[model samples]
Target: MPPTPPSTPARDEARIRDRGDACPGALRLHAADDGGLARLRLPAGRLTAHQVEALAVAAETLGDGRISLTSRGNAELRGLAEECGAELAALLAEAGLLPSPTHERVRNIVASPAAGLDGLGGPEVQLWARELDALLCAEPWAAALSGRFLFVLDDGRADVAGLGGDVTLVAVRPGAGQEPAARQESAAGQDPTAGRLHVGGRAWLVAGADAPRAALAAAGAFLDAARAAGNGAWRVRELPEGSTPDVAGALDRAGIAAEPVPPAESLLVHAPPLAPGPLGTASFHVLAPLGRLTAAQLRALLPAEEVRLTPWRGAVVVGAAPGHQDHARLAALDSHGLITRPDSPWAGVSACTGRPGCAKSRADVRADAAPGSARGLPVHYSGCERRCGHPHGTWVDVVATADGAYLVDGAPTPRTALPDAVTTARTGAIARAATPSTPAETTR
Candidate 1:
């Protein structure tokens, strides 16, 4: 039997928001200590070569000379002049990056980075992502969605199905028989290309062709629930207790046939991010060190037809040059300081904008957490208690302290011994629960 959907926290335990989300966007830049910060959402993380060039140009000309990748497969440009918003918007509009200003921030979508390239996955879900993006921008109500709202399209590989999306659609391969319960409501007949739509803890089986619309309808239902709850909830997961979205009703109202199904364990499995290196004969995957890409490093990925950013803060150069040319391109990227191999010391290490970039940072965590040999587990360095940009799932948490020392999974370690401590913690040499010196705080 399928497992019961987990229950949400009680009402008293729910976090009630008091204000609107302040997520920065291309047009709505956030004032940061570094300067104006703008986040550009890349649905399906798709970017043409020209678009890449445009981003490189924008990073060099308008903001910082570096581009930071967000965990959600988005790009961020920091240290911008406040008045450069218009110029930045114009530049993005020219590159076809900004389809609609109203829907720009709400266009958070992540898809399988290796889809259509590697033969392991089902169908090309990126096509669905593109269609859903167009549908989202055209709909007036979609703009009400919080910038944090996410849509994950897993192309049967289960790579991105666990990224905590508000609405997740995983393609089902042909001949993969459905559960008997799901088959009972197939009045519209079974589709050869079927997909599962998951919202909160509920799941539904819908035709692959109708998955996009069904996903959108699910989001609308969440918005309705959010409104009724009268709490400033940003994500479907943040809705009040007992407020699970009525996805089946929404899909029915949209004239799309769907079958209520048990949430699949495979969808929520913690799949590691795509490894960095050659993905296929025609594609190369690489990661930006510390999730920050200099203009030179970003350009090194160019001369390709297309690039798809991954949720793990990496990019896949698709349709790469053939034969010996591909080898040369890979070498160029490695020389430019991009992580071209999975075994690199920087592979599982990430840090937030510490010290000078963030006023809350007590130490320069990035400088201190420089590259070293690969550890057994992922490690993240946070400048403050609010660990921004930390990796999901099990990881070694390293936070800077107020006393000029550092915490390796809550164990106090002097600055001089930080490297060894971090390595030891990542290797799980000493298994202990993290006990931060300061009270735990949420990321801004």
Candidate 2:
């Protein structure tokens, strides 16, 4: 059986300060071992169709013509030649992508993918997401946050909210008794928007006027305290003891109402939205075998549709043709190992770029963990022992130990005896080793 999930520790109060976050942007790409890397932050994981075309164009014209989806719901372009940096930056800026030079990298925000499209008559979670993004963009202090820091705006459904974001805004469904008060002062005359706001597992019931604004203010408070502390922490949960104020206190400073809801039965799972029905279009998800894309593939992608970069180390190609992806198109994608349906062995498998891509990698794990070649739940490929992009919630963990590769969930099983460790991890069954001669695992 899988190990019992680890319990979340209480928030620490220790203050942390940082020189600044080193997150990269399209304008300012980072030179990695493999090549130049650029990260494009996707606030709320939402994009317009035109912007999608621009990204494909940018990837082809500037970098290696391949696009990568990051674990932060952002996009990356890799293997760029040094000569193209300035031209690439200028092209991205012209596309309305690189907004603020100083603030480009720190604009890390994630919102539920189903926010606006969900028809639960819920509050406009998308509205709150956009409003918060605007607030972050306008604030100078927010730039102090590390590139890894994250903000999640979840519609009470808790989808992206469960991904362990530093800041979260969850919607509350109001009771019938409050309907009269809700309508008279509601932002969009909606019932879903009528409930209290919660932060850091604490609740705040604000007057309708202060609800949204206070949430932004609350984020500011967290940032302020984090900067005051000396530690170089990126998230609120990482603050030193007594550094982070209680959620109620933060709201008190912001003048927002406070309340507490009963504990939830299950954390939200971000399964891709099912294909759209006859009347409307539905968003869809797709995975990049190694978060690497070719220039030709970029050009071939439909430019009119916006794409979502998932924190799951995959990209969701939204606005797929309704009913189902065209059969021939599906075949073409399959030829490239980009599976659209759920049953494909590639469904739950994800790996990071090892070997030539990352200096700390122990092996070229991607080449060994090719899609369909392996099978398993939440399988992750790591260069060294540090598992960087492993899924946060629940899934099997495959790590590269000094002795050999190991499967981590409860116990660590050495790869020396397994027939094919890679295939076993991917498919969830034991098999013979596919290749001989194991790569030596090293630690720094």
- What is candidate 2's CA lDDT for residue 85? 78
lDDT of each: 0.80, 0.57
Backbone clash total for model 2 is 25
lDDT of 1 at 58: 98
List ranges where model 1 is wrong by over 4 Å. Answer: 1-12, 176-191, 263-267, 371-373, 429-444
lDDT of 1 by residue, 1-444 (tens): 111112334544555768887777889988778899889999989999999999999999998899998878889999999899999999999999999999999999999988887676754588899999999999999999988888999887678887778899887755554344346336225555566888887788788788899889999999988888888778786787877888888999999988777555424544678888776677889998888899888888877779998888889999886756777787888888988888888897888888788888999988888443485777878898678877665667778999998877778888888778777776665443231211121121
Point out where model 2 deviates above 4 Å: 1-19, 118-123, 175-191, 194-198, 205-212, 246-282, 298-305, 316-319, 322-336, 370-376, 402-444
> Each candidate's TM vs. the true structure?
0.91, 0.77
Model 2 C-alpha lDDT per residue in residues 267-358, reported as the tens digit of each score:
33343322212112444455566555565554444542655555654445555555565444555655665645665555556666677877
Worst 10 residues of 2 by lDDT: 435-444
